[model samples]
Target: MYIEKIQSPANLKQLDLKALKVVADETRKAVLNRVSKHGGHVGPNLGFVEATVALHYVFNTPTDKLVFDVSHQSYPHKVLTGRVSGFLGDMEAMDAVSGYSSPTECPEYDNFEVGHTSTSVSLATGLQKARDIRGTKENIVVVIGDGSLSGGEAFEGMDEASELGTGIIIIVNDNEMSIAENHGGIYKNLRALRESKGTCEHNWFKAWGFEYKYLEEGNDVEKLIEVFRSVKDTDKPTIVHIHTEKGHGFAPAVENKEAWHYSMPFNVENGSSLEGPEHESYDQLLSDWMLQEMKKDKTLIAVTSGTPTAAGFTAEKRKQAGKQHVDVGIAEEQAAAMVSGMAKGGLRPVWTVVSTFLQRAYDQIAQDLCINSNPAVINVTGGGVLWMNDITHICLFDIPMLCSIPNLIYLAPTTCEEYFAMLRWAILQDKKPIAIRIPTNGVNHTTEAVDAAYGYEPKYKMVHRGSKVAIIAAGSFYQKGENVVRLLADKGIDATLINPRYLNAVDADTLDSLMTDHQLVVTLEDGCKDGGFGERIASYYGPTEMKVLVGGVKKDLYDRFDLQQLLSDNRLLDEQIVEDVMRSL
Candidate 1:
C-alpha cells in the first residue's frame, strides 16, 4: 500500500522517516512475493532495499550518478525508479522488469549493462571524471559491496578517486556476500569490523586514501538518511561501510543467507520455494561430480572467484578438499593467475564461475593460462544469454572469443550427459586450457543416446543434409536447429543442421566439404552477434565468397532481450531460412 502512493523518486521526497520505514517494509514484501512467484535474487536485493530507497530519496537520480557494483542488488533501484510497479505492482506484470539494472530497458539506469561485480567504483570514477571535464556538478555515488573491496579494480577506483579528490560517495553495502557468501583476506577484515561493532583496526579504505565511516543498523531509514546527509559532499572521496543482514525484513532469508541468496519462486508464508521439487543446480552437479572425480586424482584442485557457495561446494567440502579448493574472494584476476600457478605445479585445476563474471579474467585466461598452454578446466555456468537482464558480458559469446585465442579450446555442452563427456575429454586433454560453456537447460535428457551425442554424433555432425540451406548450430541452439530442420522437412525443403561442439576447432574440413554442396551456412548461437558462432564461420571462410548469415544479440545490452526479435532481425525464422534456401536453389 505504501508502494502504491510512491510513484517516483520525486514522490519519495515528500515522505518522512516514519513513512520511509513503512515504504521499505512494503518493498520487502513486494520482493518476497515476486521471488515467491516468478523467482529471482533475494538476499542481495532485500539487503539493499532501504539503502537504495534512501539513496534515491537523498540524491537526485537521472542526474546524480549511482553505479551499482554487481547490480544484482538493484532490484530495489528498479522498484523505486519507474519500474517499481510491473514486477512489484502485483503478480500481473511479474515478468515485466528484469532482475538486474539496464540502461537500455529503462531511462533510470546510468551505468554499463551490469551483472559483473567490482567495476561500479571504476565506472563511477569515469562518470565523475567526465562530469568534471564537462563542467557539470552532480552527486556521483558508487555503492559497492564489501565483497567487492577485495577486487583490485575497486581498490584502484578508490585510490584514483582519492588522488582526484573527487567527492564520490562509495556506499559499501557490507552484507558480506556478493552471491552465496564471500572469501579472501578483506572479508576477514569485514567480519572483524562487524564483530568489533564497526571499530576495525586495519582499514583497507584508509590505505586506499578513502575517508572511512561505518554504520551498524541498515534498516533504520532515519539513521541511513542521517549518514547520507552527513557524508553527502565532503572535499575528498569517502566510503560509508554499512552492516546489514542479507534478508533484513524476512525471517528465513535473514538466517539462510546461502540458500536464499537467489531463489526460484518460493512460498512467502514460510519462505519455502514454490518453484518445485528443488532439483540440484548445475553448480551442485559440478561439485558432486568434482568430488567423485577428485577422489581418484589426488592432483585435482578447484578454483572459484568468491563463489564456491554458488558452485555448490560447502565450506566443509572445500575444507575437506584442503588446498584443493581456492577461493580468491572477489578478485577474479587473482584467481586466474592462481589457477595458472596450480597448473604450473602439475595439478589439474578447474575454475567454476558464473558466465558473466568470466569477463574480468580474460587477460589472465589468454596471457597467463592459455598462452602458456596450461592444463586447466574452466567451467562456465549460468550461461549469459539465458539471464540477459544481468547484462553479464561473459556467456555463449565468450566461447567464440576465447576460442579465437590459440591453444584455448571451448567445449559447449547442451545437456548434462554431454557435459560429462566434455569433462572427460578436458581431463585427458593436456596441451591447452579448455573452458566448457554450460547451457541453461533443466535435466531433460532421458535418452541413453544423449551421452552418445557428445562423441558418437560427431563433433560436427550434419542433419538432413540435402540442399542450399544449412544451419551451423553451436552450443545450446542445437534444439532450435532441430526445430528448423523439422520445419524444412515438413515443407519438403531439406535444411542441413551441423553441431559445432568444439567451437574453436570450427571443423573447416566439414564446412568446406559441405559448403561445396550447400550455398549458405547460417550459424545460430545464443549470445552476442559480433563475436558469436556466425561471425567465426564467416571469418573462417574469409573473402573466399561465403555469404553467411549470423544471428544473436545485436550490440547494445537490453534488459528484456527478446529472442524472437533477434531471430527476426537476423531473418532467421524457420520459414525465412526455408525461403532463403528456396531462393538460392
Candidate 2:
C-alpha cells in the first residue's frame, strides 16, 4: 500500500496530508502484522503511529535529529524509515530487526540504542549542545511519554534543557499510562492538562521554564503535522504535550492497556495470544505468597518501579491488595529510597525489581538502603543471564554491582521451595537489607525438605558429595551443576555438587569442609564471572591449596543474541563445564 511506496522521510515529504494519513494507516497494519507474528511492544507503538508519521513528514530527519525515549514506541518510526521490509517481509526479515531502537541497525534515523525509559530529553540536549557548539542549526525534537516524566533523570534533563535557552522541542506523548497505570504526583498535573485540553492553569512545563503548547487530537495526522510544523526551528525551548490513546487502533489493547503494553505472539484477527497460556512462574508464586502474608499482617506492602506485572500484581490483584501495592511509576531511584523509608518507619516493605532496571538505583540501594541497614526485602526477577539479549536490557552485570554492596544479603534460590523459604525469612527478619535473586530458569520444585532458616544461616547445601572435583553452582545454574556431575560420572570421575544459596558472601565453613575431599572447585553462576558469585569462590580459595575454575559469561555487552550460541561461546553448557573439570584434573 502507501507504506510500500514510501522508503524514507524524503519519500514521505512528497506525499500530501491525505497520503500521509493513508501511510499512517498502513504503518499501523505493518506494526500489527509484525508484532502479531513475533512478540513485541504493542500498545506503545500503536498509540504513537500518527506522531511518528507526522514527525517524519514535518522534519528533515538524520540532519534534524529526532530522539525517541525508550524507543519501544519507535516501531512505527522504523516501518517508515527504510526498514519496512523488516515488518512487512518474511519471518527472516522480521527476525533481522530488534524490538528496541538500535544505532547499529539504522545509524541515520535511530539516534541512540535505547531500550530503557525516560532518556530522550537528556540525550537530545547533548545532541543540541554539540550542534550549537559546531555553529549548526538542526532542529532537535524529543518524543517522551507522560509516564516517563516521573523518572528522576527525565526531570533532571528537562531542568537542564530549559536552561539551554535555544530551540529544542520536547513532545510529551500523554498516552496516560506507563507499562502499567501511571503513578507519582506529576501524573496528576498531566491529567489536569488533558482534562482542560492543555489550558490547565497549573502547567508543570510552564513553571519549569518551557514555552508550552497542547494538542487534543494527537492521532489526527494533519493536526499533528500542523503542530509539529509550528514548533520547527523555534528560538525558545518548547514543550508540545499531545494526548493520545495508548492502544488507539486495536480494540483489545485499548480495553486492556497494561496487559497489551507488550504482547507475546498473538492472533491478529481478535488479539488472542498465539504463544499459548502462560505456565507457572516465580512471579505468580511470589504474588500468591505476598497476598497470604499481607492478609495476616496489615503493615506488609509490595513495591514496584512501574512494572507491577513483573511481580505478578496484575490490576485485579492490585485492587485486591489496595494500598498495600505501590507502583512508583518508571522511577527506580525513588522506589529504592521510598522502600528504605518505609522500612525505617517500621513498615514491612518488599520492593520487587527487574535486574536491568536495578542499575538505575545502585546509589540509592547502596547509600539509602544498604548503608542504613533498612529491613527491606528486594526481590530481583530476571537477575541472571536472561533470554532478553538486547544490550540495554542484558542482566549479566547485576551480580557484580549488587554483591559488592555491604549490609546487603543477596540470596540465590535454586527451587520454588527454597525461594519461598528464603522469602519468608527475609520478610520476618528485620535485621538487614536482603535482596533475593528470583530464579530465571523454568519453575522448579524439590521433593527434599527445604530448611525454613536458610537465609538466616547462610551456608552452601551439598547435594552430591564425592571426590577430588567440587562444583559450587549458584541459583539456576545449580541445575547445570547436576548435569555436569552426571557427565563427570559418565567419564568415571565422581564429582561433588554443592548449591551456594547465597551470592553476596562465601560459605567459609562449607569451603573449609570441601578442602578435605575436593582439590579442584568449579564455580558455575548464571552471570558475569568477573566480580560475580564464581569470583567470590575464587577469592575464598585464593590462599588455599585448592584450585578454582569460574564458569560464567565473559565480561562484554551483547545485543539480540542466540541463547544457545551465547552459552556455548561462554562455556556455560554442562558438557563444557565437565570438559573444563576434566582438563583441570
Candidate 3:
C-alpha cells in the first residue's frame, strides 16, 4: 500500500522509520510478484529491498547520483521511483519497466543503464569526478555487490575514487554470494569483516585508502538510515560495507540463494518453477561431456567467471570437478587471461562464458590468449539474439567482437554432433585459442557423422547443393536456412544450402565454388550484420559478380525486443528470405 503511494525517491524521505519498513515490505512483495509473473533477478532484488528503501530515505537521489553496479538489484529502486505499476500490475504492465536500471526508464533517478557486473564503482567514480569538475557537491553513492569486488574494473574504480580526495560513498552489499557461491581471496577478507562485525584489523576497503565503516544491520531500515546519514556528504571517500542476506524476504531464495539468484517464472507459494521441465540444452550436454572427459584427463580444468551455471557446472558438478573447476568470481577479464596461463602451463583449460560478458574480456582475449597463441578452449554460450532482451545484455555482437581477434578461431556449431566434435578438437589442438559459439537455437541432432577433423581447415559443408541462389547459414541460422530452402523449393527455386561452421575463417574454395552455379549468395548469421560472418562473406565476393545478401540483426541497440520481430525486421525468416530472393531474381 505504501509502495503505491511512493511516486519518487523524494517520497521516501517523507516517511518515518516505521513507514519506511512498511515500504520495504511492500517493495519485496512487488519484486516477487513481477519476477513470479514473468522471470527476473529474484534474489538480488529481494535482498536489497531494505537497503534500497533506506538509501532513498537518506539521499537526494537524482541530485545525489545513486549508481547500482550491474543494476540487476535495482528493481526495488525502480518500484520506489514512480515505476511500481510494472511490478504491481499484470505481466503486460511489467513491459513498462526494464529488468535492469536504465536512465531512459527514469532519468531523474536511475543514473545508468547497466546490466553487467562490477561496473558501479567505476561508473560512480566518473560521475563523482564530473560533479567535482562542475563545482557540484551532490553525494555520489555506488551500491556494488561483494561478488562484483572481484572484477578488475571495481578495483580500478576504488583506487581512483580513493585518490579523488573528495566525497564519494561506495556501499559494498555483502550478501556473501556472487551469481553462485562467492570465489576469490577478496571474499575471504569480506567473510572476515562480516564474521568480526567490521572489527577486522585488515580491512580490504581501508587498504584501498577508503574510510571504511561496516554495518551489521544492513537489512534494518532504521539502522541503514542511521549509518547512511552518518556519511551523507563527508569530505573524504568512504566505504559503507553492509552485511545483507541474499534472497532475504523469499523463503526458497533464502534457502538456496544460487538457484534463486535469477529465476524463471515460478510458483509463488512453493517457489517451484511454473514453466515445464527444461528441454535438452547445450549447457547440460557440455557439463555431461566435460565431467566424462575430466575423469580421463587429470590436467583438464573447467573455468567460469562467476556464472558457473552458464557453463552447466552446477554446485554438484563443481564439487565433482573439485580442484579442477575454477570460478574466478565475476571477473571475465581475469578468467580470460588466467585460462591462457593455464594453457601455457601445459594444462587443458576450457573457459565457458556467456556471450554478453565475453565482450569485457576482448583486450585480454586478444592480447593474453590470442597473441601468445594459447591453446585455450572458450565456449561462448547465449550467442546471437537471445531471450535476454535487455539492451545492456544483448548477445548479438559476439560474432564481430570475437571474430575480429587474430589467431582466434570462432566456430559456430549448428548441431550437438558438430558442437561436441568442435569442443573435442579445440581441447586436443594446442595450436591456437579457439572459441565455440554454442548454438542458441534449440538442440538439434543429425544421424550423419561429423568429421573428427572438421574444424582443422577453413571449409563450408554443402548441405543441399542446388543452383542460382545459395544460403550459406552459420551457427543457429542453419535451421532457418533449411526452412528457407524448403520454402524456396515450393516456389520452384532450388536454393543451395551451405553450413559455414567456422565464423572467423572464410572458406575461399567453397565460396569460389558457389560462384560457378550460384548467382545470389545469402549469408545468414544469428548476430549483428556489420563486421559479422555475413559481412566477411560479402567482403569475400566483393570483387566477383556474385550478389551477397547479409542476413542478420542490423547494427543498433535494440531494447527489450521481440526475437521473432527482430528476425522479421532483418528479413531473416524463411518467408522473408524467400520473398527477398524472388525480388532479387
Q: Write the per-residue lDDT of candidate 1 for residues 87-123, one digit (tens) a residue.
A: 5656657676667667766756546666667788888
- lDDT at residue 491 of model 2 (Cα atoms): 94
TM-score of each: 0.87, 0.98, 0.98
Give the local distance difference test score of model 2: 0.90
Give me candidate 1's TM-score against the actual structure.
0.87
- Model 3 scores what on Cα lDDT? 0.90
Candidate 3 clashes between residue pairs 3 or more apart in a chain or in different chains: none
- Candidate 1 vs candidate 2: which has greater TM-score? 2
Taking the candidates one at a time, how many backbone clashes does each contain? 5, 0, 0
lDDT (10s digit) by residue, model 2, range 135-240: 8989999999988888999998998899998889999999999999899898889999989998989999999999999999999998999999999999889999
Runs in model 2 lying further than 4 Å from the true structure: 455-457
Off by over 4 Å in 3: none
- Alpha carbon lDDT of each predicted model: 0.75, 0.90, 0.90
